[model samples]
Structure formats: C-alpha cells, structure tokens
Target: MSLTSPAPPGGGPLRLRDFRLLLAGAAAGQAGAQIALVALPLVAVLVLDASAFQVGLLTAAETAAFLLIGLPAGAWTDRARKLPLMIRADAVRALAMASVPVAGAAGVLTMAQLYVVALVTGTATVFFDVAHQSFLPHLLRTEHLVAGNGALETVRSSAQVAGPGVGGGLVQLLGAQLAIVADAIGYALSALFLLGIRVTEERPEPVPGASLRKDVAEGLRFVAGHPLLRVIAAATGLANFFAAMLMATQTVFLVRVLGLRPAALGLVLSAAAVGGLAGALCAGALGRRFGQARVIRLSALVSAPFGLLWPLSYGGAGAVLFAVGSGAVFFGAVVYNVAQVSLRQALCPPRLLGRMNATLRFVMWGTLPLGALAGGALADALGSRAALVCCAAGLLLFPLPLLLSPLRRLRDLPATATAVTAVTAATEDPGRAGGTPGTPGTSGAPVGTEAP
Candidate 1:
C-alpha cells in the first residue's frame, strides 16, 4: 500500500509523511517496552532476590497505571496538542527506563526500584497511547484510517514475536540492566522521530465562559450514550478478559504439565506472534474482500474454539501442538482486532477521539486483572489444564454481545458510519443539557464543536 494513498471511499487521504514517522517511532518504542516486560521481573528475582508476591505486585502496578490514568489521560489528550504530549510521554519513558541500568551499575537494584520503573513507564505509555491514536486523524484523512491502523497492527505483531527472544538474549549477554539500555534508546529515538513530523489540526476556540470539567464530562457522556460504542466495548472486554486468563495459565501448564522447556515455550509463543502478524497483514484485504463486519464475526467465531486445542495437547510434543494452536488463535485475534479498531476509529469524531479511545481501552483492559486472578485461583484449585479449558470455553462464547447486536447484520464499514456519526454528534457538546441524538427533532451540533 502506498503510504500516501488518496482518501478512501468515505474519508480523507493518508498522511504519508507524518504517519510513517509515527509508525516507526511507535514500532521501535513498543519493541523496547515488550522486551523489558519480560526482563524486568527476572531482574528483580535474579538480581534482587525479590519474592513471587513482589513480582506480582510489579505487574499489578503496571496494570493499575492503565486503570488509573487511561480515561483522564484521554481527556487530557483531547484537550492538548497530541504530538507534544506524545513526545513528552516518550521522553519520560526513556528517562524512567534508563534508571534501571543506572541502578544496576551501582549494584543497588531493588524490587522497589523495579516496581517504580514499571509504574512510571506504564503511566507514560498510557498518555502516549491516548495521544497517538487521537493524533492519527489529524495526520491522515478518514478513508485511510483502516490501512493506517493495519500498518500499526503489523508493527505490533512484529514486536510481539521478536521482542521476547531479543530481550532474553540481551539479558543473558549484557545483563538485565544493560539490556534495558536498548529500551531507553528506543524511547529517545521514537521521540526524535516524532519531532520531525508536522501536522496541524483545527482547534476549538474557547468560549469566554467555557469550563474544562464540562469539556471532560462531554467526553464521558459521549462514551456512556453511544450504542455501537457500547457494543464494541462489551465485545472487546469479554475477549480480553478470557484471553488474559489463558495467558496467565499457559506458562505453568507448559512447564509443569506439558514438560516443555522455557526455550520451547518461547518458540511456541513466537510462532503465535508471527501468525498474529500474518493475520494483521490480511485485515485490510479481508475487509475489502469479505466486508469488514463479516470478516470480524467469522474470525471471532473461530478463534476461541481453536484456542482450546492448546490445553488439550498436554503430553510430549504438546508444546509444538500448543504452539501451532496458539498461532491460529493469534491469527484470528488479529483479524478481529484490526477490523474492530478500524470500525471504531472510522465512527468516532476526531475531537472526542482521545477520551473515546481511553474509555474503550480502560474498559477492555480492566478485565485483565480479574482474568489473571481467576486464572491463578482456578489453576491452584482445578489444575492448569482445566483453567485453560475454561478460558477456551469462554472465548468461544464471548462474542455474543456483538453477534446479537446490529453488528452481526451489518456488512461494510460505510453502513455503520451513520450510527457512528449520530453517536459522536450527540456527545459533541455535552453541556447541551437536553435529550440525545436520534431523539425527535434533535440535531447534533456541528462536528469539532466540542473542546478537544
């Protein structure tokens, strides 16, 4: 696909210059972060002799950052210059991550320090993510959002497949502290790349009597009232919740039950990651050929059933079989996710993008902790295989909300644009103090009327 392609059927053209730089920066930064995700806890355990509970606490801290800052950060992004916010977030992550190496060099690495680093990096990441997605429309036209989002999925898939192996090797060779240096560098480089991009957006002129709280509330009200958005949120939340359960249980099942080595586990996950990339690459083509909604539904239908195959393969060579199954599941997940993201982005007005994005992510990821907790408890009580089986069953059935909603009956992206517009238009000025869109004689205010 040409990065500078013309406006798609319903929207504006792709901003090749800005999108490419942002893509590069995002890819590099994500790769670095994924690598550290594995290395950090290992560093705490091996270098500092931290307990298992401490390691769990570290994970909790990171997730808590998402839960705490996601919505507010989204609100903040909507109200600010997204690019500068993104740049600052990257800089903060870079500095915070660099401290890992500094502490290690001084022979003073501690569990507390690791948790702090994770918290800071994760919080910065929350802000960067909200800003980045919100900023995309300003750079690219409406039509190109699908392809642009596809390109991003490609980067994320590649990172997922490669980052872990690279991180493990780096930790072995350079030590965990020095290994983190790469992440710090990646963040700095990402910021530098973003600095080179230039794009201007129309800003809301403040009403002499405007209220910031009112502006934030407008975003909240928008999210709460949209039907399609609500459906999307429910479907995604269910999917993420079940997926987290499987992930939490997989390692133990592989090592203890399946008797796979760490290397084998890595290999299986890598295969899945590559499969995820393949699925993402196919999303645009699939949407074009089969129609977006159809493809999404079909993928969702198949993903969970196949995901079950992993736990069933519990003997010798179970590792390889589980890996293959994982790859299939990942592929299906990519198809579903890319289509969903494109749909949501296409539907939302640019002004409300940050809060909408944040609210969606917060709700979707919010279930992760519950899933993790359940997985742990189930594994201890019923065994790891049973826990995974439960996850697979949940996944197979999780798409009920979307399937039952108007989503199943829909076909192309264009068909849903009206619903998106109405929903977004209703929230444009939350301060209207009246009925909503689709109400008798109620017309949405002009787009871009809401203060970011």
Candidate 2:
C-alpha cells in the first residue's frame, strides 16, 4: 500500500493499514541494513583479510557517528519535520551503500573506505531513527501507543532473526559487496514507500524572533530535568553501554571461541530474534497485568543474568547452551525496550518531543563508542572469552541504578496535575509547566505517548 498518507483516523490495533505499511517499511529497511552490517564485516575479514582488531575498529568507527552527531541531530529534528528527516536519511544511506559496489569494481575498495562509508551511513541513521520515532505518536491515538511500539519491536526482532541469514546467504552467493547492493535497494525502497505517507507533525513554528540555540537548549533542559526521563536516560544509558560491549565481541566469540560456521551463526542469531519478538508481543499484556514500571524492572532483572552465558561457550555443547542463553537475554531486551518507549511517550510533552528524543539518545547512544573501544581493548588484553564474561557481568550490575531509583515504585502514571508537580519539583522550574516539556494534558492516554 502507499505509505505517504498518515494512518487512517479510525485507529484500532496495529493492523490498521498505514500502520502495517509503516511496519513493513521499517522491517524491510532494517532487514537490509542488518544484512549490510554482517556482510561488511565478512567482506573485511574474508575478502580484505582484516584481523579481529581491525573488525573492532570498524565497528567503533560506525558507532562513533552516533556519539558525535546524535545530540545535534535531535536539535535539528525538533525544528524540522520528522518524516522528511527519515526520508532524507534513507536516501542518503541508499547512495552511500550503492557506492560500495562501485568502489569494489574499480579495485579501489579499501578498509579505510569501508570505515568511512559505515560511519557516514550510521550518522545518517541516527537522524532517521530520531525522526521516525518522533513521528509515531502523531500516527495513532495515545492509548494505542504501547501496542504500536510493540508492533515496531516485533518487526525489528524479526529482522534480527532473518536479516543475518539473508546477508550471509547473499555474501556467499553474490559476494559481500554485491550483498550490500541489497541494502542500498532496501533504503531506496523504504524512502519511496515513506514518501507516500503524509504526516501532520507538531513542530514548534518558528516565532517572529527566536534563536536556534534557545530552541535547542529548551529541549535539552527538558530531558535533563524531567522525572521519568531522568530515570530512563540513566537506565538506557547503562544498558546500551553493556550491549555495545557485547556486540563488539559477539562475532569473535561465536566464530573463534565457539567455532560456529557462518550458517550456524545465522540460525543462532535468528533464535534470539524469535525470542525477542515473543517478548515484544507480550509486553502490553504484561504491562496491563502488572504495571509498566513493574514489567520494566522484571524484564531487566530477568535479562541481566542471561548475558553471562556468552562467555561460557568454548565450542562444544557450550554453543547450544550459549545460544539459548543469548535468546533469553535478547527477549528481555525487547520487552524492556518496548516498555521504555511507551513510558517516555506517555510522559513527554508534545512540543519537546524531538528534543527529548535527541537528549535521551545522545546520552544513551554515547556509550556505544566507549563500549566498542573497551570491548576491543578487553578482548585484545584478556581474550574474547574474558571480554564476553566481563560484559555479561557488567549487565548484571547495570540495572541496580534503575531498580534503586523511584522508577521502581512508579505505577500508573499520575495525571497532568501530579505529573506537572513532579516535573516542577524535579527541575525546580515552574515556567516549564505550561510549555512543551510539561505534563501532557490528557489522562488515561497511552503510557508512552511522548516516547519516540
């Protein structure tokens, strides 16, 4: 279906037409992107004969863009129409990816070029992700927020499960550079589809005389001070820190330590994706049965211990056990992510949505580079096995801050009055009460109405 139109007004479950199209677009793009990510490294290793340290450096380069550009991108997103940002990002990535084949064909492809392409594409991705998320609340009724976010999570999980296999297959059949062509095509297709959907974004219209810095600062302050936001920033930042470390080391551990073939790696990764999908699907039910905060806390608790299993794989029956453990950890991550997004959207004010997203992402995503660098360093010094163990242990301790915070006790989110009061108390700034970062006016809205 055409994706250019806003979701139909009669929003029900995520089965709505525009919603499905949106999900489809996101999935296609993600599947292709994952394939590219996997293929790029394989190309580096098998084709270019890069070492483990080199691969780690590539991953570090890719994520460095998020660290450098995420915050400013958020500011730009707050002032811009989010959809356009997504579209442009897709377009830019498509072009960047398509360049891989051209460079390879010319016998000019080099490790440095690949690193540059990865970094540039990733930088574009940061903006696209921020805008895409910022666009979600406008697409459905506030009450449907959790379910909608769940749907997106399902797509992402499915991509994780399937994308790697496709990437590996393409790499095997068509060569890694050619496989990257699929990712380029996916981005182009995503942009074409997204271009069809129309959205009425809620950007703050430029005042007769407002400075860009002031506008950006306003968004930053909201995140720095908001109650739920403060907790979310802290929690997600830690989770990402450990996750990045794990990701940096996972390939090495699986291939070298566990002795898994590329095909087996795909299957194992797919299993984790399946588990993650299940967790996303169950998030809403769990939230309804328990409380949102309770679900978040429980998921964190359950996921943290499973991370330790990664280090246990020494190639025999250990491989099987590690795969199962990885699936469980991924499952919990999916659940936690869905719940977190829903909570943020529900708590954030409309006007400050872009800034809030940017701020949170800046803080959370900033850990990726550090984690990548540390992961490489740890592996070099202590071996991949030790590095995996360290990351797993780190995961266990990651949630302690969240669990000890007031976020653990938060139940049904307070209405506007109490929410505003909380925000005011948190920030010690009364002027913020009526503006963009204030408590949303609606009661009984979706818990994450402002989350993007």
Candidate 3:
C-alpha cells in the first residue's frame, strides 16, 4: 500500500485493512496491559507480601524507563521503521511477562524478578509508543486523525472495561502468577497482528552530520518554544504526577485500608473505567461542539472537584463514592487527552513528528517515577488515607496551568504550529505583520493516547 494515499472517504480509518490490523493489535495489547495492571500489584501484595512502599517502588519501576530513555527513544524511532519496532517491543514484553509465570512455577518468583520485568517492558514501551504515534500519518489522511484516534481509544477503553474483571477472576481461579500468562499471550497476539500489516514504509532519510544529542535538543526546543504546547505539557505533566501517586498507592489503599478482595477490587476498577469509555465515545462530538481548545479547559475544571471523593470513601455503600469520583475524573482526563493529543499531532511538522511526541512524553510522563516514590514514601510516613488526601488535592491543582494560559481565552486551537507562532508574534507585537496561517500538517496522527 502507498504511504502517501489516504483511506477512502466515509466510515473513517476503520474501513482500511491495515488500520483494522493495527486496531486489533491495540485491542489485544491493551487488554493484556489492563490485566497486568491488576495482576502485577496483586502478585506483589498477595504473593510476595510487599509493603506499601514496596508496591510504590514496583509501580515506579514500570514507568522509570520513560524518564531514563524517553528522549533518545524518539530519536531512534524516527530513524527506524515503526511497525518492526512495535513488533519487537511486543515480543520483548511478552517474553518478560512469560518469565514471571515460569519463575513462579519454579518456586523462585521474587520482587527482584518483577522489578527486572517492569524495567525491561517499560523500556520497550517507550520505543513502541513513539513509533506507533509517528506511524499513523502514513496510513491515513489528516481528516481521519481524530476519528482514528477515537477508534483506538474506544478499543482501549473497552478493554479497560472488561479486562480487569477477567483478570480478577483469573487471579481468584488461577494464582496471580498464572494469571499473568494472559498478558504474555496478549502481547504475543499483538505481535502476530502487527505482522499482518502489509503497508511498507521507507527507511527515514538520515540528516547529514546529525548527532543524537542535537536531535533530542531540537525536539525539546520545539515543545518548549511553543506557547500552547507549553501549557498543555504543564497541565498534563502535573495531572500525571498526581495520577501516578494514585496508581502507586491505590492498590494498597483498596486492599488494606478498605479491606477489599481481589475480585471486588477488579470490579471497582472496571466500574471506574466506564467514564473513560464514555469520554472516548463522546470526544469527537465534544470537540466539534465545544471547540477542542475550550473543551480541554472545561474538562479539567469539571473534573477537578470530583477528586475529593477518593479520600472520603469508606466501607460498604460509601465505596461507591470512590468509583464515582474516579469515573468522573477519568471522563475529564480522556476528553482532555483526546483534544490535546489530536491538536499536537496536527500542529507538528512531518519530519519532527517522532521527536515532538517524544519530547512531550518526556515532559509529561517523566514525572511518574517521582510521583510514585513520593506516594510510596508518603503512605509509609502517613497513613494510606492521608496519602490519598494529598493526591486528591494535587489533582485539584492540575488544572491551574490550563486555566491561566492562552487556552482559557481561545475557542479552538490553531491547526498548525506556524499559525500558533504567527499568532503569538502578532499578539506580542501588534505593529508587526505575522505571516498568514497554514492548514493542519498531515505528517502523522497520535496513537496510544496518554492514559490518566
């Protein structure tokens, strides 16, 4: 298939064979990931008898690669074909996950092994995610980007809706060790599906005298210099920081503080994901109705207050408060993510797609490890409920960056980076003439949009 050609107009990217394959692979991979999200911590808590801080350390390990290799991964991804890189990532993740079950069967499973697997898989994910986002523009037209992203998010959300339930059931029926086997199988299936994509991409043309450091710096400059991107990055980074705290401590809180079993815990998570699913379903329409830029701020403003419900949750019917709060927060996050990510993809230049994504991810996701450590340490120092209170307060503060930025005044984001820069220049110096704005760049669209 030709890389320059667009999918047939009508029915979105779903009608394309290659897109279908990609979506199928995403479905497989996301389902497994959701399962591991539940089973991994369960293994640490249930089998290894990990303490609160140890569980936080485990969560930090899973995301530390983003801080360590995030920038260079983007440079490498831009230098290689994305499909093969994604396949290799899936293979690595599958193998890593498979080792857990094998080691458990051999009576040698330990926190050390889990940490190694988390680090290895997290490194692979950095590459896979950068490549996946960079590859989409080659497969579909600019107009299809939002729809394509929405479709992928829909499958992911659906998996979140069901995968945790299945994982919990598996944990109850089979041991947590054996339950992880499902994640390995899912990655294997994802790899197989990726192999079926027939689209061929030419190798990226290397820049003359290019060094990795310079390339990485260029990506950083592009994001940092952009007025809108800076605000979006700040908001997202703060949100992820607090979200990471929640991730690191939520299992410990639910399992110990609330006294929930594995099965009940999964159901609560699944229930919370319903909001993400709804947000995915409504994102495209919301963007159309409320302008994407406006929606971004509105989503955050609406969701911030709901976070207080988490620390207030208690046993029995009051537990529903936690689920509702989480659901409301997730809904806002998904909507905010879909709008901002699509805007980012639209604005970036073709050659800089990989670097732009990588830079943004580094800025946004790099805080995860720090947040995890803080959550773990805080939980150990204070009680788990106290830690939850801190995270909830942090969540309320996440929207401050957006509310204070130019996004608050704009209805829709400009379609191109050139336009954004031009507008900024015009606003700063009213006497000078800025160039005419350009249309949205058709370089690439985002896939695997950030999870909250």
Candidate 4:
C-alpha cells in the first residue's frame, strides 16, 4: 500500500489493493451520480412542475460550485490528506441527497429544497473530485497512470451505461422523488469503500507565507503558462459549455418534444453512454497506437460532427438519431478526457497536483452554469430543439483550439512539463543548445519521471 511499493503479481494498477479500493469507490459514486442525473431533473420537471428555465437553473446550481470555490478547493486539497477529504465529501453528499427523499415522503419537497440539495452536493463534489484526481499518483507508478485512468473511466462509463436505466426504472416504479434514495445510498457506500483504502497519505508540507490567494494564483499561472495545457483547457472548457446546454435542455426535449416517458428516457441515455464505455475501453490502446496527442486531437474532430444530428432528431424512430449522435460525442469525449487527464497528471509536480487540477476545472467547468442558463433561455425563447442546434454548433467548434495548437504537429505529448519548458527555452535561443529535450544533460530530467 506504500507509494513506492511494487504492484502485486498481476499487471496494472488494479493489482494494488489501495487502487482497487479507490476504483471501487469511484464506481459506486459514479453509479449514484448517474442515477441522480436521471432522477433529479425528472423530479424537477415532473413532480415539481418546473419550467424549462427553472430546470436550467437547477442544473446550473449543480455545477456553480466549480466556478465559485474551485481554485481554493485545490489549494485546500493540497494542504490536507486527500483521502480524508474525499471521505468527508462523500458523507456530505450522502446527507444532502438523502434529504430529498425525506422531504418527498413528508410531502414537503419543493424546487427550493432541490436547489439547496443540488448546490450542497455540487460543492461537496468539487472537493471530492479534486482530491480524487490528486490522490491517484500517490497509489500508482507513473507508468500505470494511463491504465489507472482508463480503469477509472471504464468504471465510470459502465456506471453511466447502467445507472440511468436503473434510475429510470426506479422512477417508473417508485416515482422520481423516491428514486433519489438510491443516490443517497450510493454515496454512503462509496464512503465506506474509501474507508477501506489502506494507503497512508502524508500531510503536504506547508509553504512559508502561502496565502490562499497566492496559492490560487500560482496554480492559475502554471496552467496559463503551459502551452499545451492552456489549449487543452480551452478545448475542454468550450466543449463543456455546449455539453452543459445539452444537459439543461435534453430532458425537456425528451419529454415535451419527443414525448418519451421516464423509463424510455433512461434507456435512451444508457444507449448513448454505451459509446462512452467503448471509448474508455479503447483509450489506452488508441493512445499507444495513435499517440496520446493524436488521439486527443482526432477524437473530438471526428466525432463532433455527429452532434449536428442532435437537433435533427424527432420523435419515434427519429429519437434513435439523438442516441446515435450523443453516443458518438460521448465516445470522443471519454477518449479525449482519458488521454488529457493522464497527460496532466504525468506532467504536474506532486506538490501542485491539487491546485493544477482545481485551476483547470475552474476554467473548464466554470462555463457550465452560463451554458445552462443560456440553454434555458434559448429553450424559453426559441424552443428545446433550437437550443440543441446552438449546442451542436458549439460542439463542432470545440476542437479548433486543439487543432490550432502545437498538438497538431506532435505525436506524443511531452514526457513532462520540465521537458516542455526545456524545449521552449531551446527554441527561444538560436545560438546555444547541446542536449535533447528529455536527455539528462538538458535543463533536468522530466519533473515527475518515476522509477518503473
């Protein structure tokens, strides 16, 4: 369970007990989230009789925390033991989600209560996700990062594949309000699984005179200064904005425009996520064959055009088009995510992982609330189908940032940030350079290069 210890006889991060525990916890948590993804909006639209704008606002509430507290969460995550933080976050989310069912049973559930629960759970999720990503390096070797991330994504994608179907069924059988009880139980189970992880993470060393503002600023500077990271952030942020639009409006379109019931809606979502599961399965192999940089670039470019199919979708047989388009986009997204997230983790210094992830999240996810609001407004002004058209257009444009960047010329990403810095420095000086970028004689070995 120690950081430097060898993996058990089998290959991959799964061979490690701590990693298995972490993966299990993630699986449980993601499954619950997927269920809530279906149940929450249904409750708002169905039971609460919320308008399109109101539903959009509720969706916005779920992600607003990333914009509000994202940077500071990273700094705080770095300063504490990540496992404990993750555990506490799960507990907080469980309590928040559990209240919904309680309120529903008491005949007191309202849009206001749902908003409060969403906001509270969203805040907890910000902390949990930051700590979770930061904690991975502590349990696995550098070489294992891709496989580790791939495994996590696989579990997440699997949950996405199954959870909504189950959630929809639960809603059909037990109603939306009662269906959320599953998410509460899921969070509680995730906390228990995490409690079983045996790895002991040491507290991060305190920096002298390090204020929260300074720490936040340092993380931002690092992300902004990195050429590839900046481009990745931009691409991801842009994609997320449109994705948020889809999230905000999809339920309305499915129910009002397409006239699908809760059960059928879940089936459609599960089908869409099948592509994400496939992408997660293929990510590691694709990275090895096509190169991570190429995969990152091509994944979005090739699949994004399918998003145009979303707005074109109609009822009955035409609904299948929505699933097809969504599946293709989800596939591309999962592959892009696995490759880029592994690259970021490999490139960052351990001391800065929390802040680095937090900063990037703020940039990428901060757009979500705005996009949700936009989607809602569009749905009100034009219609759900029109809102989807705008979202599809935005998705088609998402890959432009990556395509315009140096990633277009590279096969693999740089081994580390230090290697990138060295190359940047060398490129700037036409008169002096002796060693190759990753060679020992260069600036230094890649900052986070680890023993196999």
Evaluated against the true structure, the overall lDDT of model 3 is 0.86
lDDT of each: 0.71, 0.75, 0.86, 0.88
In each prediction, how many residue pairs overlap at the backbone (N, C-alpha, C within less than 3 A)?
2, 17, 0, 0
lDDT (tens digit, per residue) of candidate 1 on 242-276: 87777566656765677654345545666667878
The weakest ten consecutive residues by lDDT in model 2 span 437-446
Writing each residue's lDDT as its tens digit, candidate 4 over 292-402 gives 888999999999999999999999888889999999999999999999998888777778889999999999999999899999999989999999999999898999998
- Candidate 2 vs candidate 4, TM-score winner: 4
Off by over 4 Å in 2: 1-16, 200-204, 417-452
Residue 130 of candidate 3: its Cα lDDT?
A: 89
Candidate 1 C-alpha error for residue 265, in Å: 4.0
Top of the candidates by lDDT:
4
TM-scores of the models, in the order given: 0.82, 0.89, 0.93, 0.93
Scored against the true structure, residue 379 in model 4 reaches a CA lDDT of 97
Return the clash pairs for model 1, or none: 11-143, 12-142
Comparison by lDDT, 2 against 4, better one: 4
Better of 1 and 4 by lDDT: 4
